[model samples]
Target chain A: MKLEILAALNAEREARRAAVLVTEIATGKQRLVREADLASDPLAETLAERLRMGKSGMAETPAGDVFLTVQAPPVRIVVTGAVHISQALAPMARLLGHDLTIVDPRTAFATPERFPDAPVHAEWPDDVLPKLGVDRYTAFVALTHDPKIDDPGLIHALRSRCFYIGALGSRKTHAKRVERLTAAGFTDKDIARIHAPIGLPIGAISPAEIALSIMGEITAALRLKPASAAQAAA
Target chain B: MLATDNDIMNRAEAWRREGKGVAIATVVETWGSAPRPVGSHLVIDDDGNFLGSVSGGCVEGAVVTEAVDVITSGAPKMLEFGVADETAWKVGLSCGGRIRVYVERVD
Candidate 1:
């Protein structure tokens, strides 16, 4: 409730940075815990775990019970393709509480009419990806089958630590695509991050179904950790 | 309209600035069959009016009922509810799940 604390919390929200307000349940003492400051907090271990999950909760600590009210920025999905699947995906991502931007070099397909809600960039990835400012909270999906556009987008996405990167292509096509990326200087680990054929396999045959599957897969990728890590956390 | 978490926080701060007491109820933890995820929030004013939801249909009434007291007493409280617990079932947490909620008066 201090004026300084209030200003700091509001500033973080304005900047769309993730922060947690830690409250001491016993004495009503409190402090703001920005994601950047987690490493130095006394409750660093639990704070990092909760911040990764991006949830507010009561944490039992040696000091006492502390309630962490997390303020995480909304996730943004950067898509390179303004095809039919993107038409379905733009709205779908918004409904799932994600902010999305679609980039396509084709002005004909990347029209405001097709995506009334999301921003459409009729420019190449090389020109647009930097403008979008993809970050750790950003998810990159290349729905455009054109290697020229999709490959460059993947390179930019991999250069940073965007949480998810998926590309649309069949397994055979993806193998060839991997070869191309490898030759272009991506390591196997970086290539492994791409969800080739993109989306969870729910027998998606329609554009809408495929969009739904892609969102589902992205949600799983964000919320569900690997089995071994999950067990360790438990 | 559904209020986002920031909306709830901002609104609570605005209400306080306007001299109206505010209390926030947040879902801190949940077990099986929890309809809402942890960190979901419902904010209430001194008048018992509220925005957002803590549970789809469970434990909300009790949480709000306590928020009024929180606004008056300026004390924070933590509550737990579960279907197996008879007291929780009486309070409408009959969703075959367990949830812990922490309510505090936000100044």
Candidate 2:
């Protein structure tokens, strides 16, 4: 029984998935809790409530004994340009355990020779992006600086609910791009989703500095607390 | 008995027991002009161990001292050192930033 429990814990950790083991420690009623959906998991629901209340340690359970283990998955970064900034950004993103992919229709730019260790896709955005299936866990960046390449990618990214959609450009260029997007029927709200002039206002001049600013902005976007929720929490 | 810290230690210990060498690095706190934030950690093993950060390079000597003790005794410790200390100037942290780092041997 102990070996079985250990094995389950190991498997969950290996998969990088969260699990809760509900056991009646006093009564020795041990039941492994696995729910298809997190919301439906009673043990997880209870544990989350307890955590929110800042409570820990053994808790009485109607069942037997229960322990919750959570393993967070690594983040993913999908760069839609094989530009110079991407050459620097990809390595840093990889160090942070972000699975990165570089897509560009320009085969010369997207070749592995340019991005030695990255996954390169030498295909058009419309052809390549849908197969990748961007998700909420994914961060998409349109760094091509050319609307012909960046626009279709941004449209795809915005439609798929990616967590971050960043486009590299000047303020004037972005304004012009927005006009084009609006003409194409994207609502203001959809346009607002983009992080144009993508990086932080760090006055970055070089490609590496620009990459750093973009990374910093992406990190902030990921970690920043929602302003609307502060009032609600207060 | 913080569950998060305990869990992290347990995992490190398990790796050590399986022939993996472990070193724990802690961030005590940050004052000014620190590269890594407070509470950032770098863990290293026998081959130059690292996990978290103490201060970019300013107070690494003090952190290494605690780390060596942890490797020998398998005990945890809270080490505090900052620019206010006399030695901080020698470590190149005289820039007015201070940090406290806690190093432990989880294995």
Task: State which candidate has the highest TM-score.
Answer: 1
Two-chain DockQ for each candidate model: 0.45, 0.07
lDDT of 2 by residue, A59-145 (tens): 555665343323233356888899999999988776665668899999889989889758999998888899887755567899998
lDDT of 1 by residue, B1-107 (tens): 35666666677777777888888888888899887888888888888888778778566778889999988898888888777465433765567888888888876
Task: List clashing residue pairs in candidate 1.
Answer: none
Q: After superposition, how far is residue B48 of candidate 2 from its true place, in Å?
A: 13
Q: In model 2, which runs have C-alpha deviations exceeding 4 angstroms?
A: A1-35, A44-68, A226-234, B1-107
Each prediction's Cα lDDT score? Answer: 0.82, 0.65
Which stretches of model 1 miss by more than 4 angstroms? A1-14, A53-55, A226-234, B1-7, B10-20, B84-89
TM-scores of the candidates, chain A only? 0.86, 0.76
In model 1 chain A, which range of ten residues has the least summed lDDT? A225-234
**If you assessed candidate 2 against the hidden native complex, which CAPRI class would it receive?**
incorrect
